[model samples]
Target: MASKNCCVMFMIFTVAIVQAVSYDTELFETAPCDSNACFDALHGALGDCSCNVDTIDYFNNVKIFPRIQSLVSKDYFRFYKVNLKKECPFWADDSRCAMKYCHIKTCSKDSVPGYVDEHENERPAEKYTKIDQTACSTDEDHNPDLGYLNMTISAASQYEIAKWNAHDSALENFCECDDRDADAEYVDLSLNPERYTGYKGPSAHRIWRSIYQENCFRPKLNPYESFPYVLSSDLSNMCLEKRVFYRAISGLHSSINIHLCSNYLLSEKGVDFAAPPEGEWGPNLEEFQRRFDPSQTHNEGPNWLKNLYFVYLLEMRALSKAGPYLETEEYFTGNPTEDEETRAAISNMLSVIYSFPDHFNESAMFNGGSQAAKLKNEFREHFWNISRIMDCVGCDKCKLWGKLQTQGLGTALKILFSSQWDSLEADPEQGTLPVRHKANKRLQRTEIVALFNAFARLSNSIRQLENFRIMLSANKEPEVKRNVFEGGGANIRSTKEQCSSGGDKPRIWS
Candidate 1:
């Protein structure tokens, strides 16, 4: 009995020591990199794309980021149309999230500006003219600046009336989701920001699991295995197209995790886990570490982070390619001043992106001998299916962002790989390809919004990563204590004790 007790104590002591070492290692791995070293680390050939991370970092921080922020906040880009009431096709369980944060507050039709009800007899152009006139006249201030703004806005509205194309039904081929459903409604994206909603556990995991298992074109390894394990396998042997698919999905996953960590609800002394309280929200370093630190994420953190950059470059390349199309599109929201500003911001963003010498070459993809066409089709189908899976997500907020980002990515793929690129006319003087007017190939307004917004999300994630690194390096992270229930939920223990004893499994959330 004495010997057995000694053996048990030794095992417990060993676990404690190992857990302590692991915690220390995680901290060390996440320590902030020197400025030069960090940029240098990001410099590499990601798949077919080669870019200087320093250049991307500088452009995004100084030039493009601010413009994207401004553009997304504009009237045209702020509203998103989605069918939140769609049932999950994969499973019968339609129990949506119960958490308050999980639900999105939708905008009423009356509150949405420039929204044209199909039941009304008035044409969109005429309605927009009325709204624009009202906006210009309502202001009490008759200053010269206000007059200039109104003039610019009116001009923009007139220009949009001449050029704007209604939502194209044929463009639905690029997106898998049914956006034309009568039940669909416009959501004010600014009001429903993507943040931590405490929607985690089996439901969240199942969604990602289905995505990776059914959608990603990976070799038949164990399909039931965890994502990190499957991702960390020998990906070097995979074909370029397959690799790109996997990396893009992983990049999106990393971005979602980053958003959650950046805007996590900090645990306080009087925090109640039973109900959703308006808790203090800020960066939670421990949550960041759990999702991203190499020591905790099966050594897949660095790879996932690198993939995030790859996706950014891929989407940026698509934007660069679609410059002519974007420039021609009108952003009319009935508010002329805001519409003009939106166009200017987009133009500035494009200029900055165009100045960058290194952009991903779409031609490098889908070149696998005789199987190239087949492979390309497979790639498109897989991404489309992934977009469809967004409907299965239990959280309304997560579903909203998921559908937008995925649709955006799908649009990028269409721009890159579709036959539409062949139709672009080259302008020798401009040194850019201007999109030829093809009725079936033009990008829809929703797609344009999704494309830029998705890029903005990825850019923000990269910035958040840097912020978290600084916080970790400065040792300014507050210790978050989680309550561990014990003895039939009567006794409470600290997360420290749970960590030391190896008594808790890692919590993976979306």
Candidate 2:
């Protein structure tokens, strides 16, 4: 009886310990980046496994889709687990506070700095060593998505460029199957004036058109003729449809500007006039009081909102030029160069998406030139394509999609808008924060549901998890499969029954 009693006590204590042991997610809430050990214990490791464009490109082309099943529904958890481990240096992963996230005290236009090193009050930032990830090899059981996020972005870019050039013969030449294998001479980017013109800005497509008219369509067709990112339309038409291409570009840029998004959201310029605040006008604001009482200044919104606008301005200036980057051999030569034309073009186009708030700004696209609701539809079409790309890589928690759909755009929407702060603040009376509006709204919902949906038939169950793993292993998560059952219920009864269909079908992802 004495021995049994001791055993019973031990069992009780053991159970308590088990229950107390937290998931990586829980640890994120309790303690974030204060200690390096905290991130390690929760996120698994903290070696130099940072990601970049080349790596992302490689993964998208090879392994990203393969790791979706194992961790699909766990995006919220993953976000917590990989917060400091995966997202830091550029941003904070403070899992404890709801309001503080990906929160950087200050940011630089250059590479993001380590958080703890910059802020003594903050926790230790996770640092990675190196990863020996290859494009596609039958090697390990680790998340294949982890290995190729950048490649996925590149592939998506290729897909978008292809869609734009679908109508032209020369445009077709720019693809993999072109007659001269237009993709082959990409090494000569510097020499091709039409394709490689160093000029870049909002009018980049114009240069592309100039190239086509002079070379590609001019009689003999120089087999060597190349135009930077083939043009699908004239400059004005491209600008009109800029929202289409800009959607993806905006996503990519927002991803690059992740650290600044939260701040941008709080900016007065971030909000669309069509979408206003839920509250009534306040009286105590110093700026407001000053305006009404005299000898005072008009404070339209908070500093966060003002800062949000500045961030957008900075990002837009950079986004407008995303095109020349393709013209530089960098797109093909795999080098680095961002021309003014490309940036302007990218910015003008992307502004349609990120500048969604501006379109509705009771001010109406006066400066942005957008009409109410015109860009909104185009925004969804663009976002849908981008969603498919991320979906292929096992990412479904994307905030941009919800924003594009107006299905309650989340804080992630901040990433999709441009800085209209100047105009807002300029009003001296009217101001808003779409960035905060979107982010706060998104925070109200579960962050990981869609990530699970990204994987086909991933519901809550052992069978579902097992099926998911197999599909991810083969990079087949995005591929369509024939399920044993046909259409049955009106909606899904539960997550348990959504297990993936067995293999054998394939379709174009985007």
Please tell me which predicted candidate would have the highest TM-score against the true structure. 1
Question: What are the root-mean-square deviations of the candidates from the true structure over C-alphas?
Answer: 13.9, 31.2
- Badly placed stretches (over 4 Å) of model 2 are 1-235, 240-375, 394-430, 433-442, 445-510
Model 1 spans > 4 angstroms off: 1-47, 117-174, 220-229, 267-277, 368-370, 424-432, 478-510
Compute the lDDT of residue 385 as modeled in candidate 1.
Answer: 64
Best by lDDT: 1
Q: TM-score, each model?
A: 0.73, 0.20
lDDT of 2 at 157: 58
